[model samples]
Target: MTVRVSRVRQHSVWASLVSDDAQALRGWLLQLGFAEDLLIPGERVDAIHHCQLDWPEGGRILLSSTGERPTPCRPGTASLHVVTADPDAVLARATSLDARVVREIVDQTDYPSRDFTVADPDGNHWTFATFAG
Candidate 1:
């Protein structure tokens, strides 16, 4: 039998990242100003383990350290875009953490916003912007 439902409640969006060193990645995220309170911490059960950084608006970035080694995102492959009030301020914090800048802050002609991109320790691309989304 085919089950059908009318109307669904969209709850949250979760982004997961597999890291070779979850601890160091968590530290780097902390340096970028993601407070410890946002983290739910990790739990290991058998051969699986996972943790998450809860976003204020219901989204989350799940940081997992298990399974085979992960292959970092290739250039131009993918990027995580974060909308914030102040992109410059975020840039400063990232600078302090010595994160690699993939792109300097600039106003996009077409996008109608200011943003910057940086590569995390594991080579994942993250873009912080003032875009209202």
Candidate 2:
């Protein structure tokens, strides 16, 4: 019995963001990155909840205005980690957006990675990092 398992092709990942200030968050995201709407029609930042933004490469962020956190962690908890080519660029953008930097950008010897954490306008934390060899 030699059955090999193959990995499935992932189309996109949906990151849900529950926030009271969905409009502000959406504005920040739009300024940072993500297109208005290309694939779907009427997918703008009009609704209070169920709003989504398409990423340039792949994946989309689902912004909900339910004011209910999805994760089981604390209220202001964001463990979002994004691996990118240039972390400094992302940090610059985040800085321009006036995002609160929880963890300054630095090279971590323990994890062998360069990363930084920033808190969004709605209190969600986002971590952008680059893994090094």
In candidate 2, what are the lDDT values of residues 1-133, reduced to their tens digit?
4434353534356676665566677788777666655222123454354567775645567665544334443424556666566779888999998899999999986665689999888788877776522
Deviating ranges (above 4 Å) for candidate 1: 1-11, 37-48, 55-58, 68-78
What's model 1's lDDT at 32?
Answer: 80
Over 40-128, each residue of candidate 1 has an lDDT whose tens digit, in order, gives 43454322145666544334676656453354623223467776678898899999999999999999876568999998888889998
Steric clashes per prediction: 0, 0
Candidate 1 lDDT trough over 10 residues, lowest sum: 68-77
Residue 56, model 1: Cα distance from true site in angstroms: 4.8
Looking at model 2, report the run of 10 residues with the lowest lDDT sum: 38-47
Q: Using Cα atoms with residue i matched to residue i, what is each candidate's TM-score against the true structure?
A: 0.71, 0.69
TM-score of 1: 0.71
Candidate number with greatest TM-score: 1
Once superposed on the true structure, which residue ranges of model 2 sit more than 4 Å away at CA?
1-12, 38-47, 67-75
What lDDT, from 0 to 1, does candidate 1 have?
Answer: 0.68
